[model samples]
Structures are given as C-alpha cells and as structure tokens.
Target: MTRGVRGATTVENNEAGEIIEHTRTLVLEMAEKNNIKPEDVSHAFISVTKDVDAAFPAKALREINGWKYVPVMCMQEIAVPGSLPKCIRIMMVVNTDKQQTEVEHTFQREAVKLRPDLLEDVQKDQQK
Candidate 1:
C-alpha cells in the first residue's frame, strides 16, 4: 500500500535560511515519525505561501542524506484570503504497509492551528 504523510510549518521570516531550516526540519520529522525512507517515497510536493519567495523548499529535500534521487517539486500555494502566511506545506507519497489512518500528519509552529484535530499526532512526534 501507499500512504501519504502531510505536514506544514511556519517560518519566522522569508529569509532563505529560515525557509530552508524549517522545511528540512518538518520533512525530516514527517519521514522519521512515519519511517518513510527516501527510496520508499514515490514523490513529494511542497508549496509555500505567496509571501514566501526567498527560496525553494525542495532544496532541503534534495539535501537529505538519502533523498538525492527522490522526485520533489515546489510551487507557491493558493493565495486564499485569511489563509496562514509564511507557511510551507509538504505532502509525501511513500510506499508503506501502514494504513492511511495510521499515517502521521505533522503541524509545527503556528501551523498547528491549521489542524487542531491532528495536535495529538504532532505531540507524539515531538515526544520522540
């Protein structure tokens, strides 16, 4: 089976370093918590809000030790009114035996408010 792990995190600023660091951290945590190896991932989609134009968050994925060959793409998110700003979102499709409900979706920083129902999932990952 294939599972999709979703995550979103916010950057304090639109600086390249901040975007890179937060993007790396969020994706790493998402992969770790779900035990999704780079080879297991079919592909990933990353999107940042329009306000974030500092850098491509996909750079962080390519930097991961084993993700060099993994397919990744980045683009700007839909600019919905009142939507979260300075946010980056990642969706990864990984080959896993885990059921969809068992997959963990992570929300970090202010992005936590975007998915309060998944707060417990985020808390579990944080405890590790």
Candidate 2:
C-alpha cells in the first residue's frame, strides 16, 4: 500500500541555513521513524509558512545522498492567524507494506504543538 508520512518542524530563524537545517532534521526523523527508504518515496510535498521565505524546504532533500532523484514540490502554506511561525511541513508519499495506523507522523520543535497526540511517540524515539 502507498502511505503518506506527515511531518512538521519550526526553524529558529528565517535564514536559508536555518530553514534547510530544520527541514533536514524533520525529514530525517520522519524517515527514521517510519523506516522510509528514498527509493520508496514517490514524492514529497513541502510547504512553509508565509514568514519563511528564505529557502525552499524541498531543496534540502537534495542534500540527502539518495534523495536526489525523488520528486519534490515546494509551496507556501496558507497564512492563518496565530499559527506557528517559520514552520515547515512535509507530506511524503511512500510505497510500503505498513498499514495506515503503522505510519508514523513526526512533529518537532514548536511544530510539536500542531500534533500533541504524537508527542509521546516522538519522545520515545528520542530516548533510544
């Protein structure tokens, strides 16, 4: 079955370096948590909040050794009042044997507030 793994993270600043670094962190964590292989990823849809215009989160995927060939599209997130700032979100579509409930969704940094229910899972992974 094909499943989508969702992840979101917040950058400390709007600088390109910060954006890239946080995006990489979020993607790597999602991959590790879900046992996602680059080859199994059909596409990645990345979106950043309006305040984050310094870099494209999708560009950071290219820095990963095997992810160069994976298709990625970057977009601007809909601006909502009181929403997290400098947040980068990704939806990675992967072909996997795992069922929907088996898929792990990651949220880190300030973006963790976006999905409190996943907090325990994220904390457990970090302890390992």
Candidate 3:
C-alpha cells in the first residue's frame, strides 16, 4: 500500500533558493529514514504563504534533487485571518509499500513551532 507523508517549514522569505535547499534536505532526510526512493515519488507539492513569491519551492527541489521526471506543483497557501506569516508546506506522494505509521514526517526550524511532537520525532531520528 503506497502512502504519502506531509511536512512543513517556515522560511525567511519567498526566495526559492533557500526554501528549495532546506526543503530538499528535509525531504531527502524524510525519504531516507522512511525507506523511500526518489523514483518512487509520484509527486511533490509545495505551498507557500501569500507573501512568498521568489520561485516555486518545488522547482528548487527538482533541480537540487535531480528529480527531472517527478511531478511538481506549487501554490499559495490558503489565507487565514492570522496564520503563520511565512510558511512553506510540502506534501510528498510516494509509491511505497509501507504502512502509514512507517512514514516519517519532518517539520524543521521555525516550522517546528507548528508541530512540536512531529519535530521531536524528527530530531530523535536525526540523532540516530
């Protein structure tokens, strides 16, 4: 049963370069820990808050990861009256044969503030 994991991060701005680099690192780490292969990724979606507009975070990931064939999409996050100001969220869809509980999701940096439990898990995994 293939499954997908979700993760998110808050960026300094909309510039695709930094957002992309950090996202690539996080995504790769999640994939590695969860035994997911890049080729198995059906798609990777990036959602930026309304204020971000440097480049598509997905494009940066594709370029950095050399995922030329992977489908990528970028969009604006829904505007809430007062939500996290500068956030970039990622939803990775992978063709994995693992149970949902086997998937690992990462929320790093300021994004960790959104989900402390998930961030703690990621930290524990990294220490291993």
Candidate 4:
C-alpha cells in the first residue's frame, strides 16, 4: 500500500541555513521512523509558513545521499492567525507494506504541539 508520512519542524531563524538544517532534520527523522527508502518514495511535498521565505525546504533534501532522484515540491502554507512561526511541513508518499495507522508522523520542536495525537502514538511505539 502507498502511505503518506507527515512531519513538521520549526526553524530558529529565517536564515537559509537554519531552514535547510531544520528541514533536513525533520526529513531524516521521518525516514528513520517510518523505514522509508528513497526508492520507495513517490514524492515529497513541502510547505512553509509565510514567515519562512529564506529558502525552499525541498531544496535541502538534495544534499541527502539517496534523495537526488526523488521528486520534491515546495509551497507556501496558508497563513493562519496564531499559527506556529518559521514552520516547515512535509508530506511524503511512499510505497510500503505498513498500514496508514502504522506510519510515523513526526512533529519536532514547537511543531510538536501541532499534532499531540501523533506524538502520543510515537511515544506508544517507543514504549513497545
């Protein structure tokens, strides 16, 4: 089955370096948690809040050893009042045997508050 793995992370600053580093961290964590291989990834869609204009988060994945051929797209997230700032989110679709509920969705830094339910699931998996 094909499943989507979602993740979000907050950058400390609007600098390109910070955005890239944080995005890389988030992607690596998602891949690790879900056992996602580059060959199995269909595509990666990345979105950043309006405040984050330093760089496209997808570009950061180019530096990853096996992501050179994976298709990636970047977009601006809808601006919502009181939403998290400097946030980058990614939705990656991959072909895997795991069911939707088994996929790991990660939220790092202040972004963790965005999905408390998923956080709980991750914690449960760790306790197993």
Candidate 5:
C-alpha cells in the first residue's frame, strides 16, 4: 500500500539555503522514521507561503539526499486570509505496507504552533 504523510516547518528567514536545509532535514527525518527508502518515494511536493521565494525547497532535498531521479516540485501556497507566514509544507507519498493510522506525520517549530493538534498526534505516536 501507499501512504501519504504531511509535514510542516517554518523558516527563520527567506534565504534559499536555509529553507532548503531545514526542509531537507525534516523530510529526511520523516523518511528515516518510516523506514522509507529513497527509491520508495513516489514524489515529493513542497508549498511555501508568499513570504518565502528564495530557492526551491526541492533543490535542497535533492542535494541532501543525492536523489537523482526522484520527482520534486515547489509551489506557492494559496494566500488565505489570516494564514501563517514563513511556513513551508511538504506532502510526501511513499509506497509502504504501513497503515494510515500507523504512519507518522511531523510538524515542527513555529509550524507546530500552527498545527498543535497534529503535533500532539505525533507526540502521542512517539509515546506508543
């Protein structure tokens, strides 16, 4: 089965390098915990808010993971009223046998501030 997991993170600044590095670390950690190999990644999509326009977050992941064939994309998040700022979100689809309920999602830093519910779920998972 294939499962989709969502991750959200925040950038301290709009620097491409920093955003890329932060995203790279977050994605890699998610992949690591789920035992998802690079080859198992079907695709990765990154959405950044209007405040971020430095380098594409995907570039950082490609460089950090050294994935030459994995498809990646970066898009602008819809500007909704009262939306969070400096937020970068990632949704990754992985081919795995794990059930959706068993899968782990991550939200960190100020991003956690945006999704305390999701963060609580992750924390609860860690305890189990």
Candidate 6:
C-alpha cells in the first residue's frame, strides 16, 4: 500500500541555507520515523509558506542520497492570514507494508503547533 507521510518544520529566516537545512532535517526525520527508503518513495510534494521563497524545498529532497531520481514538486503554500510563517511542509508518499496507523508523521520546530494531535502521537510513540 502507498501511504503519505507528512512533515513540517520552520526556519528562522528566509535565507537559502536556513530553508535548505531545516527542510533537510524535516525530510530526514519523516523518512526515518516512517522507515521510508528512497526506492520506496513514489513522490514528494513540498510546499513553503510565502515568506520562504529563498529556496526550493525540493532541492533538499533531491540532495538526499539515492533520492535524485525520486519524483518531487515544490510550490508556495496558501497564505492564510495569521498562519505560521517560514514553514516548509512535505507529503512524502511511499509504498510500505505497515498499516496506516503504524506510519509516523513528524512536525518539527515551530511547526509542532500546527498539529499538536500528531505531536502527541509522536510523543506516545517515543515512549514505546
């Protein structure tokens, strides 16, 4: 079955380095928590808030080892009023044998506030 593993993280600035580094961290954690290998990934859809135009989040995904050929896309996230800024979000879809509830989704930095429920799941999983 194919599952979508979600992740989001925030950067302190709009600089390319900051964006890329934070995005890399979020992607890596999402992959690790879900046990997703590059070969298992079908594609990744990444979006950055309007304030983060300094870099393409997809660049970070491609930079990962063995991920060069994986399909990916980048776009600007809808600018909702009062929404979080400097946020990069990713939906990594991959084929896996694990049940849907077994999949792990990660939210890092300030993005953790975006989904406290999922963060709670992560915390519970960490105790296991």
Q: Which has the greatest TM-score? A: 4
**Candidate 5: 10-residue stretch with minimal lDDT:** 60-69
Clashing pairs for predicted structure model 1, backbone only: none
TM-scores for the candidates: 0.92, 0.91, 0.83, 0.96, 0.91, 0.95
Lowest summed-lDDT stretch of 10 residues in model 3?
59-68
Once fitted onto the true fold, the runs of candidate 4 whose alpha carbons sit more than 4 angstroms away are none
Best prediction by lDDT: 4
lDDT of 2 by residue, 1-128 (tens): 89999999998888999999888988899999899989999999999999899888887899998999999999999999988988899999999999886788999898989988777765675788
Residue pairs with clashing backbones, model 6: none
**How many clashes show up in model 5?**
0
List runs of model 2 lying over 4 Å from the truth. Answer: 120-128
What are the clashing pairs of model 5?
A: none
The Cα local distance difference test for each model comes to 0.90, 0.90, 0.77, 0.92, 0.84, 0.89
The sequence of per-residue lDDT tens digits that candidate 3 reaches over residues 33-126 is 7777778888888888888777777766666545777888999999998788778888888888777765787776777777787767757867
Task: Give lDDT tens digits, candidate 6, residues 5-115.
Answer: 989999998999888899888888888888888999999999989999988888887898888999999998999999998899999889999888788888889998998
Give model 5 RMSD, 1 decimal.
Answer: 1.4
Candidate 1 local lDDT, 42-125, one digit each (tens): 999999999999999999988889998989999899999999999999999899998776788888999998988787764676
Predict model 5's lDDT versus the native.
0.84
Residue 87 in candidate 1 has what lDDT?
A: 94
lDDT of 4 by residue, 1-128 (tens): 88999999998889998999999999999999889989999999999999899888887888999999999999999999999988999999999999888998989999998999888987998899
Q: Which stretches of model 5 miss by more than 4 angstroms?
A: none
As a TM-score, model 3 comes out at 0.83
Candidate that beats the other on lDDT, 2 or 5, i.e. the better one: 2
